[model samples]
Target: MPDVQDCLPTALYRAAQVRELDARLIAAGTPGFELMQRAARAAWRALRRHWPQADEVTVLAGRGNNAGDGYLLAALAQRAGWRVRVLAVGDPAQLGGDAALACAEARAAGVAILPWSECAPLTGVLVDALLGTGLSGAVREPYAQAIRLLNASGQPVLAVDIPSGLCADTGRVLGVAVRAELTVTFIGLKLGLFCLDGPDHCGALAFADLQADPRLLATGVPAAQRLTGAGLPALAPRPRNGHKGLFGHVLVVGGDSGFGGAALLAAESCLRSGAGLVSLATRGEYVAALLARRPEVMARGVRSANEIQDLAAAADVLVLGPGIGQGAWARSLLSGLGALDKPQVWDADALNLLAAGQLTAPAGNWLVTPHPGEAARLLGTTTAAVQADRPAAALALARQLNALVVLKGLGSLVATPSGELYLCDRGHPAMAGAGLGDVLAGLLGALLAQGLTMTAAAQLGVWLHACAGERLGRAGRGLVAADLMTSIRDLLEEHSPCLK
Candidate 1:
């Protein structure tokens, strides 16, 4: 499939939207059967390219258009002198329209079709075509049993359109989903394929538009957009005479006694991410360590919220949270910053405090980056509920709080108060560490300080952060949060060069 992650279309749609696009394509002169044939050919080509040595095939067919694609592919493989057989999970008599025509074609080509049984003796690359994107409920009966067997078969598998039992809208597994080695999706890209459980089940993804007209496809609205390097907002180049004062000052307020590293990581990221002046308002004891670590940062030990007034007034933006515990000191610091009118980026304990009702969110010009757990608290729901439909959760958080929101996770989402949603499909498992969120919070503050709008900063900061982690993640396990700082700085320069 050639790793089409960067080349895929950014506009992601729900299942119904994709069906609408398919209908439009069919209405515009292309026969439905012809479209099915094209889809089959696309999947066939991808399969051949992916598994060139495999000469035999076993297809699990269910009576839908998805099964039609499989039947047609089986016919193609049969004609090409390869052994092919179809285990009809969906009764052949139940097939209709294009699917019925496809089954007849397979039979005409002398391909063996048999009923699905518990002991089907599966062999050769398995093809999953049991369900299409129209699936909304959990799998039932024999199909679920077939899916379980396919998963346990220990054979390479290819899913037609979408993997059966995987929600095409929310990537949530419905009872059981076929885990395919390669998934060839047709028409439009489903939002579920890139987020939540989608990536794990879909494996290597390949998309085929089925020759649909670009104009017709553009008419439909997208549910959300996948962030790509070319489409992201960029920072302008700095002038030759630009100095420290030209870029805004960023004040990082957090770092309780025990979790001083969290606040320091944020301050360091801010300094490296082009914030002209970065100041840290943390515990008195950590000041010496921070200064010794990064003397460029103006690190100060403040005992109370009253001590932060002068610093807050002088700063252009504030990055609150990282390492701020839920103790009295943290609460007092958060309470003091509540009245400040500056643009702020809140993370970690700041979100916790707000979720606990200890702090009332300020009116505007602020953003919050929270993981699923924190987001659940903010929404008065469970983390599992929040993760079930991340797009909805992020949009709801943005609208409810009336603030820019970055729901951080595998497929991190950036949501605006106006309901615009952007998803970042970058980053790797290697980034599953403690201090990464702190670094992201700092990076967001730096972008805001450097004059990017809250929306632009959130989107660009997330892209940079994810891409940096992805690049560093190449080294594999043991990727520390500090490892991302230098890579992010380089990526930022590459994304928006220092010089024009």
Candidate 2:
């Protein structure tokens, strides 16, 4: 079996979409049973490689074809002269088609087949073949019990296709899912694997296409495009004659009172991400500190909306609301910018103010970066609801606001007004602290100011930000918000150098 990690698939599909692809493959000459065998072989190969010394196996089997994969794997283990047991959590009498055939083959091969009971000893490497991509609702009845047992087994567990009791579409834990050490997914890459609860449940994911026809795959459109080095778009190369004014001016307006650092972070990002001229319109008290910190930026101590208006008039792009509190000052800035034609990126409290009805969502040429909580506020929903389907929430935000949306967290989703969605599955947990959003907002501003379209800026900024975080996260833990600034420029140059 080939290592799926080496040759990764960029297109992600819903569970139903993967099932459709499976049906299409079966229709295109590969038998369903044969595909199941291929899947089992892939899982077995991954399992052996993962736990080479663990020969003994306990497979939790259900009624569906997922059970078929388990049964077939038990037979494969038996043939390899390894001890194997198939605990039938699903009634064997109800097993149908390929699954029934697989059960018969496993039994004839002298594999120990026992009805799953509470007392069944879960030993060696546990195989979670209980439920696959077909699960639509909560893990019910005996399957739920089996999933609980598999989780509690405390043994090395390998999930077939996906972790049992996890939603294949939304990555929602369906009444609790198996905590598999390795999850071998088949056919197509499911969208649920990287977002929400998916990453928590799926320890490590491996994909096997089961030798599907390339022509068959060509007929299907992906639900969302995955952002990778191979597929990402970067800034175009700069000519040797490029100068400071060539990249456009960026105005970062935020940093109310105590949150002065938020605005400064964005300002630093502007200079780092190739913004030719950067201006900062922040609280009066922060001016000396910002100017001393970064002399490249023209830091202004803006007392009123009138002063910000003067800066907004001359700037090419605006990054608003890094540390802008939901006070009189924030409202005045929003009202002043209401008439500006410049492209903008709004984040942090800007989203909060928008959700709170204090600010109007701009029509177009603006990008909004919101975490789940901010997204929920903007959508008039709860954080749980937003997390349930992040992709959908992102799209809704874009459509409702008629602006480009970056729903930040986990697999950060970028949605455009034209209905394009891109997922950046980069970044590290170490990059999960305060002030990150401010950095992202500032980076987005620089990208847009460099003359990238709303979609291009959102996508590229997110990729660069996440990729930088990933590169720096190697140091391990305590990754603060300000750490991303310099690496961003390094990566930007590496990815799309200014000079040819």
lDDT per residue for candidate 2 within 275-307, as digits (tens), equals 899999988898998888899989998877777
Winner by lDDT: 1
Cα miss at 222, model 2 (Å)?
1.4
Candidate 2 local distance difference test against the native: 0.88
Clashes of each: 0, 0
After superposition, the stretches of candidate 2 with alpha carbons farther than 4 Å from their true spots are: 1-6
Residue 187, candidate 1: Cα error in Å is: 1.2
Q: Tally clashes: model 1.
A: 0
Q: Write candidate 1's Cα lDDT for 1-500 as tens digits.
A: 01237868999999999999999988898999999999999999999999999999999999999999999999999999998999999999999999999999999999999999998978999999899898988999899999999999999999998999999988989989999999999888999998899989999999999988899999999999999888889999999999999899999998998999999999999999999999999999999999999999999999888898899999999999999999899998889686689999999999999999999898889999999999999999999999889999999999999999999998899999998999998888999998999999999999999999999999999989998988889899999999999999999998899999
Residue 467 of model 1, lDDT score: 89
Q: What is the TM-score of each candidate against the true structure?
A: 0.98, 0.97
